[model samples]
Target: MRIVSRRAEAVVFGGRGDVTVSPVDLPEIGHTDVLMETRVSVVSTGTEGWILTDRFHWGGSMPYPLVPGYQKAGVVLEVGAGVDGLAPGDRVFMTTSKVCEPVHAFSGGHISLSQEIQSEVLKLPAEVSDLEAANLVVAQVGYNAASRPRIHGGEVAAVFGDGMIGQMAAQALRARGARVVLCGRRQPRLELARRYSADVVVNVAQHEARWALSGIAPGGVQVIVDTTPSPDMSLYLDVLQPRDGQVVLSGFYPGGLDVDADALQKREVALLTNSGWTCERLDATLDLVARGLLRTTPLITHRFSYHEAPEAWSMIRDRDEDVLGVAFDWTTP
Candidate 1:
């Protein structure tokens, strides 16, 4: 392998609706860092979308020019001298970056960068392709959503939204043996959800969500996972099982996320939210993938070559109803 200078391409969310491609030079790695050459990276439409407008829940204090992405896979070009279990030529998935200052990278993975071993970085088996490996980050997020609800086998779950996380969460719920019904407003996205997971699909725009939900679980859904960027409970309050329903919010909610006090008091529902993924979740998702149990091919709705990355921002910003996840192909020069 040629020892090329460390130059990386990144998507930077500039302050107040301005975003750009900022390139930075990466010096040699320290004792605990490994330099990664990005192969592909996935864009999180909801959270990064809000960050573009500086409306994310944690966007108030974050500095502008933030590098937004946590889902990526790449080849290890160089490993820290002290690092063990990893080396150059090994393919890995990680969530770290060495971006320039004046950028609050919530967590990095959009392009090539240096990462510490202590981070949630792991080596992938040779059989797992780059696309599937990059997609694991979102899968891990979905796992967190599915696991947090304590979904048990034979239980009924209703996942709101047909975005990437919702799709992955639906699959995770299925892998855990829960019967899942994915509810969304778009027919195209609901159709895509069918291919990934979800034993049942409901188009809320075409029919009454509550009625459709009633047909699936007349007794009321035991758990509901919402992946809408600006999540609200009122839209699906009627479907929540009275007194013991568990609602998990797996996306960023920009607007006020308050429920009807009287209605919630009467139902006594539980509310939970998650935005981070653990290493355990990553390993579990990969294990399922290796076993041919988990599906991610459907979530790859939008893919762009590395040079088309500029257009990629627009694709994600004004995303069509059908787009699930936006990924940048970094194989190009």
Candidate 2:
């Protein structure tokens, strides 16, 4: 017998410039599934922002309304009959699920998401709070990009854009003992960079990359992670570490980048385009946060309940700087 509950809720974009919080079907489980009662979920500015504005370019999309969100942390409420290594009371960091249909959930983190997400779901250590784990996707996004070049202890790494991914990337690199530099056009975001252990924060509003980078790394940064949607990686090619510098493009774009292929070949700089993240990366990110090595506390700036999703969406959309991070409080109504 298959039973589906309809008590879940999701924040969906109407595709007609409207956002709403409406009832969705609570996800069910097969014999190998696990059901989670969401405690908290995070709003990824780039991903969620794009969804709200109709600018998101996800490769897979359901013909239904776009239900926005991917990061969620919660407690396991029920375990499938044959599930092992997890109990009903265990706390975990979960991504989206397809439990809620007709909503076209992108990771289904918004509701009572439950499925046999065996490897993708990682048990939260006692030290890490649900609030911090809820933002794991952002950390994984940064990890996915920074891991490409492999910042081994002493390399100078520069993360472009002071947004969530940029800040997260900077912290992730710093955790690896990299001399981290965060470059952005805003001061407030730059200020937030300090809390995550950024070695140097530069305001790139009108600054020259060559000057700023040289001032920080002297011999030029070894790795550069571009977290901005802007595709002008060539503008910062001079900062690449002479012969074998590596660049990781981790940002999302509605279109292609304007680049200079000649510049890449001449510099012998290797560019790696980040293609989201994997389950293993997510586990690694969670472990880092759990150990207090990589701090995400500074990134979370606002909290919103499920009912306040519209307001939360509006704030993240309109007030981009003041609200650097937002965690959806799903523990309540």
Candidate 3:
């Protein structure tokens, strides 16, 4: 039997509003390989959204014609030799890095862990939906972010930015028994933060956020998680308490931060940075989703088809109509 497969991918053509979708030949499945017919994929509202709008600070030298999605959920249409426990028609989570290559060859550049693709492709639990699994990748990042250092019960944690990741961080922190205070400029998003377990939501756009946070916690917050990249890191630094506090930078800020070194020294705050989730943490996140303890379904505010990818990016870029967690619907075959 002949298998004809065409993969439609999104690439940056030139500048903003210039995205091109083209069909690429799908390689045959190798041993230990699984061919997934993608049912749903998530548009990373933070990273990909910024790239689509050309707001990315990586200069124009960054790789163009890049496949702009990292999180995808699909059904296995074909399974390779020696692959056990997974069959055609089984749902699985697809996690890949920015690049991948044949295992034996290993002819690619320096094999960094981030670039190494770990296909911990497991069958999706019966309770999980395609959209939910697609979002699980990001939720894993949030989970790992919260799991780091492990906040104790009754601890005060401040999550910066009420975006998807920030909201997820708030939920994770709350699950760990931390009283989360979500900070963001958008009112609607801040409200969603509260629904996701933020004890208090501060609208930076409306009022002085630092003063508001001080009012919420007179002793200062125990932990401050920055999920939105701001040029001024002082906003987060000011909210921290003296001695034994922590600041987790989960956001991508390409610029330099203007902060008071003296203040950080005086406060004895521990600064930490987290990129994405490790393989182990990803599994833990999946377990949380399977048990229904973590719910990302409510975070999805908009959905679009593969053809509507450009418009989807625009929705995030223009901040159109209070779009929160956007996902691409690939369920239609």
Candidate 4:
């Protein structure tokens, strides 16, 4: 067997309050693997922030010195013997990679070079730009939320949180013919949601969600999607349509999330949750993005070179700027 040693660079979260770019070595590819050189990768400000501060709660115990990212667009450098429908030079979107030791993979997608399983990689469409595909997983999360409930055209849908996932969920709901109402505290994100996806924008900072929702959707909304890390389910319950309402939980709650089961039972609301991406959903999301239905590029408020990851993390943490979608350009050293 021939051996190959690959050196790469990646963003490392060394325990709480630590972020840096460290050198890494890629593992040898297996028969079903594809090695890629990342071109662009989007940051999950919410998830990465929680992990950076050791607040992430899904998995048991926070692992230190880990790579934190789960989505990127890149060029395939090599394809394994058993891999089909993919070739070197193909532009594809990938999630996670088999990063070798010491620095563990927190779903590793920010690395300069990645060796991914064939199933975890997707070939991009002709019209889909790398930037659009770079945030596929997060976009799929939105898609998952919007697709969970059964709704008809012209139904009212309320999306809580104006972050990337929330915005994406709003877009997906709009695509499904729902009149979307976006609720958030960030003015810039709320404005973007109004311009692109939502029919109405509510600043939760200025007005009460229950009051705003009740006024805008007098009969109550049929669909409620919560994408905030710390969600107030009672607020959503107050405006949920009786008997046929559906509530989708799509955020990361560090201390664990709880819902009012009695309230849900009284209204007969269907409580649903979305976690990860699926191949079919990714395919549909990529198509929607390529067809100009999912508005991704417009949401990109900041771009930094891979070397500027520290600055990017700082900006994400500080919130001094009205940052929305942050991407790291890895095309150069």
Candidate 5:
């Protein structure tokens, strides 16, 4: 018997304000394929929202009618041959690079299993909520950034941005025993950061981040995590310590980053950039989430059904202040 699986997706054409939902057929379960019914998928406000506006990878060519998403958690309804450790009716986290390829083709960069699925499509832990699982992609990126900083106990770390990725990075920094200070423009988001283990929250809109850092640590922050896609790097360069400080750039800066040469030369700081989570890092992140070491439940602020995906995209693109992490709740289908 043959089964027809209908999948709803968001397609992005050229220019901003071009996200639409349409149904696509699910291919037959191959020997290594698993047919999943998506339960929840989170909108990566920093990445997906930018993509919706054609602000990501500008001046470069992107395939038209592209599906824009990377974070998805779902239930397995069918498993293909040669697939082990995953059975039907299992709850799983999966990532698909399907959106990155040509509209009709699937790419090979999908690492959902290694990142959000916890190396295997195992049952969801009792303590982990579905919303939390849905936001695993952000947590994975946060964990990756945290791991790169090699944060040590008693070190001072500063994270720039209060979006999903930034908040998660702050939590991860705290977990590593670093004194974390979150910097952002929004009062509510900064307030939320306080609940996620941020030792200090600074509103950069009203105050200078560098000035604020002076009060937090006279020696300067050891690690600075940049979660905003600001073209000007000067905003963060001056805050690093003279010799041992490191800056990690995890946000999507489409227009390229501008930096003052003297800032790095004088401070002797190391600048690093990361796009997404690697397989190994994703595994560690899921372990942290499963073990309750990382709490992401509070980061999710809004939930929308699959049909409301367009509106959800709009909310994110408009920079809705109340939106922290918006997710697609697919329970209706």
Candidate 6:
């Protein structure tokens, strides 16, 4: 099929802490690519917020006026000639899109229409809705953390952080048959984790984490997953099993990661870091969500129309309200 010039409305990070919705030119659909019209796109609160506020440390300074998300759920509008597995009208999820120069695509995802490579897209199962699949990448981070450590069915696992990633990690650990202890300062998020993900919820603000963890797993936790940006990994040394303990670094540490090598060496703890997503991992996460093993709908606390992009950003950036699983509905106009 012949293609023509097209434009898409995107959420652009103009500069640090500046967000604007502007029209960006979209490249013509190419072979081995799929053109999609977005139905919903969710925010990776930690990652996107860091990038928007210019705190992300990986790539130095992120170029301004760039699209700043990597999670999008959409419907296929057209497919490239070489694309055999996907066709028009299929529900899909995709990563980055190719946008015309001048405006950069820093792993593009939040846009009205996106042209994604075939390899970067995944077809959704009928049981999983767009909203649930919208946050697949973030959910996969949790899955990655839970999947890293080797543990038995009844082993104890402690997850630090009550944010989306933390909650999701707790759920993933539960799905893996571990007794999950979710730790966080927010009561509401901890309550949700208690009901959905965690067997025990620890309000670290009130009581000590080590004290709370001691009652659950006396010997030591089989694995400790830190889902916060700047967590001191050594704080939980005594709580980790001497030889079999595992620690998964699931959050991005822009400031820099400090590990207590001597302390970890004494215990022979396995330290693993997880970021981004793989096609296999994404597929597995979607299946777990589809099968109702990993709950997604319950964690969602806020939703906004696509036009309310600015308002949504305000809520996420300022934390004026307790927010989790924020989604923008493009179909709402």
TM-scores of all candidate predictions against the true structure: 0.91, 0.93, 0.86, 0.97, 0.87, 0.97
Weakest ten-residue segment in model 5 by summed lDDT: 105-114
lDDT of 6: 0.88
| Top-scoring candidate (lDDT) | 4
Indicate the residue-level lDDT of 43 in model 5.
73
Off by over 4 Å in 1: 1-5, 57-59, 102-104, 260-268
Residue 113 accuracy (lDDT) in model 3: 15
Tens digits of per-residue lDDT, candidate 1, 80-109, equal 777888888988888767655655566666
Segments of candidate 2 deviating more than 4 angstroms: 60-62, 112-116
lDDT of 3 by residue, 200-317 (tens): 8988788797899899888888888888777346766667676778888788786756667787788777878787556677788888887776788887888877667667766677
Error of 5 at 92 (Å): 0.5
Task: Estimate, for each residue in 1-333, the C-alpha lDDT of model 4 and write its tens digit.
Answer: 655768899998888888899998778888999999999999989888888988886787678889999999999999889999999999999999877888899988899998889999999988999999999998999988999989779999999999999999999999999999999999998888889979999999999889899998898999989998888887777798767799898988776777878888888899899998889999999989988989888898999999999989988999743898999999876
Better of 3 and 4 by lDDT: 4
| Position 176, candidate 6: lDDT | 88
Please report, as a residue range, the 10-residue window in candidate 3 with the lowest summed lDDT: 105-114
lDDT of each: 0.77, 0.78, 0.68, 0.90, 0.69, 0.88
| Per-candidate alpha-carbon RMSD to the true structure | 2.7, 2.0, 5.1, 1.3, 3.8, 1.3
Once model 6 is optimally superposed onto the true structure by TM-score, how far is the C-alpha of residue 167 displaced, in angstroms? 1.1
